[model samples]
Target: MALAAFMLLLLPVLQGCAIQVTFDGASIPENVNTASVQLFENRAAYVNPVLSQTFTEGLKDRIINGSRLTLADGTGDVDFSGEITGYDTEPLAIQADAVSTETRLTVRINVRYENFKDPEKSWESSFSAYRDFPSEQNITAIEGELVDEIVEELTENIFNKAFADW
Candidate 1:
């Protein structure tokens, strides 16, 4: 039949145009097989005792779980090293009574990424994320939860910038 002949012809062309996709969206070069993440130091004015450790591990875990790169103690084909540059809280949503109705906690980090396989893609940048809570809430009581959420978001941003190639 004419329709059957047309379908057979199209199938070969379609097969030749098969697309390849990756779930993680990483576009690492074929030669880059390893990565290293140095401990992120806290250099903020008011440092959180555990932020350095928490952020450092979070970044390492993200790379390990999302990419095929092996973890290395020494510098690898891809390297990440940085520090926490800022951690501060500011009042937001001031009311008519001159009182703050909400407050925001912001965290900032500086990252240096080196791609040995493609030096042109290397970059250094700063990333920040923040969370808001009621002004009446004590920072000490909420800092842990807020820091965790902020770190999660910051790590994702850093990971995407470094490997997603977007």
Candidate 2:
């Protein structure tokens, strides 16, 4: 009983020596306390009027909310700048008649992340996400909703890549 009591008391002390982990999975460097997210320009073949602003804001929001970083008007310790590289559609799920039953909408963005505190950790990469809609639905009628969903997914990917080290 004495040994059991001693082990229980030592558990808390032992835990203090373990590696720290965050609930959000982010592993932002200690020196990186500020960040900047530039407006992402839409350079895709097909441009959506509000896509640039929407995507930029979404990425900013994700970083601010997910980390302990402050937003800066200009460059901060961490900088994020990117462009929408692709917005396209393709046919999926062909039917017996050789017609597509579903249409896939894909959005791709190229991201450049700079960590001034650690330049070696910075990277430039492209991220993409897609959604499928019924072939019968006109894209014009569902474009807004589809874009919102795609933006959310893209922002998560960007955040994870930049801060979560994933």
The candidate maximizing lDDT is: 2
User: Over all chains combined, what TM-score does candidate 2 have?
Assistant: 0.86
Looking at model 2, residue 32 earns an lDDT score of: 75
lDDT of each: 0.89, 0.90
Model 2 Cα displacement at 141 (Å)? Answer: 1.9
Winner by TM-score = 2
Off by over 4 Å in 2: 1-21
Per-residue lDDT of candidate 2, residues 1-166 (tens digit): 9999999999899676533345789887666779999999999999988999999999888887888888997899999998999999999999899999999999999999999999998999999999999999999999999999999999999888877778
* Poorest lDDT segment (10 consecutive residues) of candidate 1: 14-23
lDDT of 1 by residue, 15-39 (tens): 6643322477866666788999999
TM-score of each: 0.85, 0.86
Once model 2 is optimally superposed onto the true structure by TM-score, how far is the C-alpha of residue 138 displaced, in angstroms? 1.5
